[model samples]
Target: MTTRTSRRAGGRQARQALRAAPLAKETRPVRAGLEGGAYKPLTQAGMERIHQAALDALEQIGLADAPQSGIEIMTRAGAILGDDGRLRFPRALVEDMLAKAAKNITLHGRDPQHDMNLSGTRVHYGTAGAAVHMVDVDGREYRDSTVQDLHDAARIADQLDNIHFLQRPMVCRDIPDNRDMDLNSIYACVAGTTKHIGTSFTEPDFVDDGIELLHMMAGGEDKWRARPFVSNSNCFVVPPMKFATESCEVMEKVIAAGMPVLLLSAGMSTATAPPTLAGTIVQAVAECLAGVVYVNAIKPGHPAIFGTWPFVVDLRSGAMSGGSGEQALLAAGCSQMHQFYGLPGGAASGFSDAKLPDMQAGWEQMCSNVMAGLSGLNMVYEAAGMHASLLGFCHESLILGDDIIGQALRCVRGIEVTEDAVDLDLMRSVCLGGPGHYLGEDQTLSLMQTEYVYPTLGDRTSPKEWAEVGKPDLVQAAKTRKETILAETSRAHLDPIVDQAIRARFNIHLPR
Candidate 1:
């Protein structure tokens, strides 16, 4: 009896020690840019049909409201300016641009360790949205999201391993001027994290200022161009085939500055787009293909993400249902379209219609995120920290989302069938000569960290153990973690002198 107790206790100690040990980046069970594509929501024939329909839409329906400059550039690239002023694309022209568009693009980070190599079926997840309200989880209420809230969110995200990139998730509603709001958004995100960032400019004139701020952050314009870590998430097209004129101009300037562009086509189904899911995807594809032509025309082989963000709406109420199963299918189907075009693409997922990160939010966020990762989306935006159908952002939810994405990424990794993995010798030996079980096997201990993922806040204790630990609530635990992260000062921000210079030159909103 004594020997058996000692053996069990020793086994427990070994596992605890192993759990506390640091793992090399390569050995971690989940990480950025894991290969996916195992899930095919669209068949090859269906994808081919969608492609043809999109091409036909471009050739016949075309897109209206292109800026005069866009008209000139695309017209030169073989797009015909119709009598009604819509820019119609020739099938040959789209094909040429598709061939000319940049592939296997890299989104650089201020730190080299965070750079993402976007190629093949490599999948990366991150946060992206413009929620105006911040969910106060403790209060169970929403309030205006301030610049400080944005900064805090970024800092919290910087420490999360599963959040690969940090986009401006919430707006600076405290700032009154549009230009200051845009510039401050950049400052807050860049100052908080060294990961790759995605943001948008409100006006074309603001592009130069935004670039100047980036140059300052990068130490110089030449150096910034060498490793442009920020990307412009431009909503270049409105739903149902129309161009957003101001955003188009902003795209041109950002491209000239050598920053990557995300050609975002966000249409609301059953409202801005067709009611059918297939038709919604076709419109989004056609619109983004037009954007592809526009981008390549401005600069041959520019890096642009095919952002097909088609939103779903509840038919009865005409409200956005970002957490519905239909939303998951829309994102997954769009990922298939991105693969079909052979372009680095991104789509929206992980949003929750729930007011808080509760049971409904858990299922909603997980369903779409898992589907998006499995479908091999090159970039999965809004994969964390969005709630209230994207009207609210929650910091505690963002912290909780890290754990959720870890599990989702594990699913993306799927099963590996190596010779060693399937070997029966170890099993045979364990059953025959070893103790009746493999609990203390050397191989079992070694594979603990690599073969499985353990969540940071997920409870895996028995009911008795849970009582001993005070039965910690998940949301409260996340809240505590959020506070702990924001309490510590980060070393990733710019040096004091550089920050002072930036404050002097630009209207920096967040306090020092």
Candidate 2:
């Protein structure tokens, strides 16, 4: 017989269970930390303006070379399509889709054993896609990355608790062929570890191969569909507005096959789109929406994440500056747009053009990541250890980034409400000098673990104690932590037969 548990009863039972267990007091209560910094929450008025502007661009300027089928769909749905291929969407349709899209999605990581809950108050951290640096075990730097470098990067990501997902190819690893190499790298990482993976396959065959591997790993097509055993395909929409044929194909295959897709359109202000930040964001949004519509059209109710990496062009030189204020604003705006569409948003943050891990890197990473988190983005790419303008990755940066993400996450945690948290009776008792000392209180001991987050890197000791231990900086502590975690942690195990099948398909030898 099935038993029913009321919500209140369930909570009461959990609290009672906790109270019955022996309490061990070790860590201090976690401090209330900062929320996302410098990000102005988008107002309803501002969002309305953006929506109108996007419609104007679609109707007046019109998008170029969007698939005719997409245009036909929009046109039939009351969008005005110009003879020249520009189409204007009614504000109502845009709002309708926004309301219908799914805002919350759970990304299942490599360890089927572990999953990150993304909706509501929970925040997850992970690195951005496409880092080009190579760092050895001893923290020495190499100029570029190889296939082995990708493997090592996967291993590092697998060990990091803060990192909840993997974006494929950690670097452009070489195999005899790029297509075969793409599939091999994805298989190696997915099989070697258990983390949700994000991959963008340029070729159709590779997409099929990746999907096949996911089905095998997930046990079957049905199970794979339920929890997304494979990676989400990230497609770049041609911006200041359009979707390329290949990207369209990739999106179609991924969405139709029941895999999640992240549609990203990055536009450089004054270069790709208009010089104005607002204009660029509108254009970027339209471009991303166009891609989203395509996916939705192929398979209605397909899971898709709408996103952008819009940044300002260094007007003086035409380079993309990772640290631009415009980028932070775009991240925030994109989050709002995703909310508008009722879909989760992804954006690049925690990255800088700085050559090393220094003040510039810290500030740039902090500002962008905090903005993304505060705006309530679903998945943030480039959350850790990117430098040299996102073309490089450093082991030290990864260590440092863990702390930064921790701080950002702490900000989004909002506030918790419970009877014990309110503690009105306890407060009244203290007011009467009835065991006013919190140090000896049963409540303090009971709630500490639930309320606190112990840091692996930040220094919390006294100056004398810190000096006595070793006056190591945050980076040093992080390095030590990285080593310890890597050493003790085991790679997620895979079935021997499945591993063999993957190896035989790819013609690569599995490590004994």
lDDT of each prediction vs. the true structure?
A: 0.93, 0.66
Report the lDDT tens digits of candidate 2 across residue range 135-193: 44354455776655555556677766566666653565455576766666676666545
RMSD of each: 1.1, 7.8
TM-score of predicted structure 1: 0.98
Clash pairs, model 2 backbone: 62-86, 98-341, 109-195, 109-196, 110-194, 110-195, 110-196, 111-194, 128-382, 353-389
lDDT of 1 by residue, 112-166 (tens): 8999988878999999999999999889999999999989988988999999998
Residue 269 deviation, candidate 2, in Å?
Answer: 2.4
TM-score for predicted model 2 compared with the true structure: 0.82
lDDT, residue 385, candidate 2: 77
At residue 138, what lDDT does model 1 achieve? 81
lDDT of 2 at 67: 58
Model 2 lowest lDDT segment of ten: 25-34
